[model samples]
Target: MSVDPKTRPPRASAVRKAVQVAPTAVGAFYATSMETFRCMFKRPFHAREFVQQAWFIAGVSIMPALLMAIPFCMMFVYQINILLAEIGAVDLSGAGAGVAIIREIGPVVTVLVVAGAGSTAICADLGSRTIREEIDAMKVLGIDPIQRLVVPRVLASTLIGMFLNGLVSAVGLVGGYIATVYMQGASPGQYVTAISILTKLPDFLVSEVKAAVFGLLAGLVACHLGLNAKGGPKGVGDAVNQTVVFSFLLLFLANSVITTLALH
Candidate 1:
């Protein structure tokens, strides 16, 4: 029955343990996502939770979306106007603005705000609950957390994401117009006239699609990290941070892929 400490194997390092656990973590996340999706059609939909989450996400995200979209879109339009003026095509400034704002800037800004504000909020809320053992209590009471919690949050995020995208696109266009016409001396009438030249119905639709996908992914990331959090409060905080980072990475990758495929 005697055991020698010297003959025992050394414990695995943190780095080694993390590496070993990486694949399982990813698999768990995937399973969570599938289960969340499947539970979407389950009876007793959490309408109130969805509404509350949507309101929360919108409250956190809307102002940031407005404030961030203006400067970014305006500067981009200003630069485009300068180039177009140099080439004697200043009238086409609206086309450039429209293309940039709708096809990229609007969705991109929505991505940042949703991931930074909305998704982080979701993660923090759920993570706090997890740390408080509320999630486990729900499970003990035979409540399906995914149906009652994750589904509503995900749907709310997706709805808010699409709404924010539209709001950002409109604000971005106004900002771009101001930059082009007032700042760059572009003909206001011509600028307005050419907005629909390069951007049409399909571009608009694709942009909305991108926003929906980004929101869905961000929500999934937030919920997964929150539910799996450990180490008490520190774990919850870490999960929130990871939610933002992972949401951004996934959103950008989705954007690139969606844009490429849409264009082709």
Candidate 2:
């Protein structure tokens, strides 16, 4: 016998509601992102909050960045050196390392760390605030939560993104150098000198730009999901997970688009 509609489990209804709300959620997120960007230039910048958030994000991210960069860059250089040695182009190993690390690996790795650590932290903080009704209370007090909370966090993420990009690039280059010189038996001087040969000013700029954009998007995703979170603590956890998923999705898409445009 079929169950009565009223007696049926609520799970199906909840699933349907989620499915129906997905598009609306996307639109709401986009609107919130635009508002956050617009508020960035508003008066009374939250310098203290920005600094705190930046320090927090950096603290969570730096060690992971180092651990990831060293092995990744070393492996990259090792593989490239092996191929180069086979073709007698071992002197160009630095060029290969420089191009890959600066243009792609640095920004990508930074994105992963920021999304995993920084964005999730932001989401958890705001999600907690949301579940505590703090955000609603702020609105009741006539405060724009986007201006007060989001702009600073987004800016901090962007700043940290650029900084992390530079840090990762440096560390990766050092790792690449070690791999090339010690492991692959290439000349250290050649590795250092040839690094700038294939990689140029534009590449550096694009990589930094990519990092900034990725950070900004990650912050936006986290904030949007956090602010919209409901159903209490479980909802907050879901929002944090969504923050990581959506941030990575947006970041990789933006990377592809920006890289393509820059290439042209």
Q: Runs in model 1 with CA error above 4 Å?
A: 1-18
Q: Residue 177, candidate 1: how far off, in angstroms? A: 0.6
Q: Which digits, one per residue and each the tens of the lDDT, describe model 1 over residues 1-264?
A: 966857655564556778998899889999999999999989899999999999999999999999999999999999998898789888899999999999999999999999999999899989999989999999999999999999999999999999999999999999998998788777888988999999998999999999999999999999999998899999999999999888998999999999999989
TM-score of each: 0.93, 0.93
- For model 2, the superposed segments whose C-alpha errors exceed 4 Å read 1-19
User: What would you estimate as the lDDT of candidate 1?
Assistant: 0.94
Report the error of model 2 at residue 63, Å: 1.0
Question: Residue-wise lDDT of candidate 2 within 1-264, one digit each (tens)?
Answer: 988989878999899999999899889998998899899999889899999999999999999999999999999989999998899999999999999999999999999999999999999999999999999999999999999999989999999999999999999999999999988788989999999899999999999999999999999999999898999999999999999998999999999999999899
Cα lDDT, model 1, residue 46:
96
Backbone clash total, candidate 1: 0
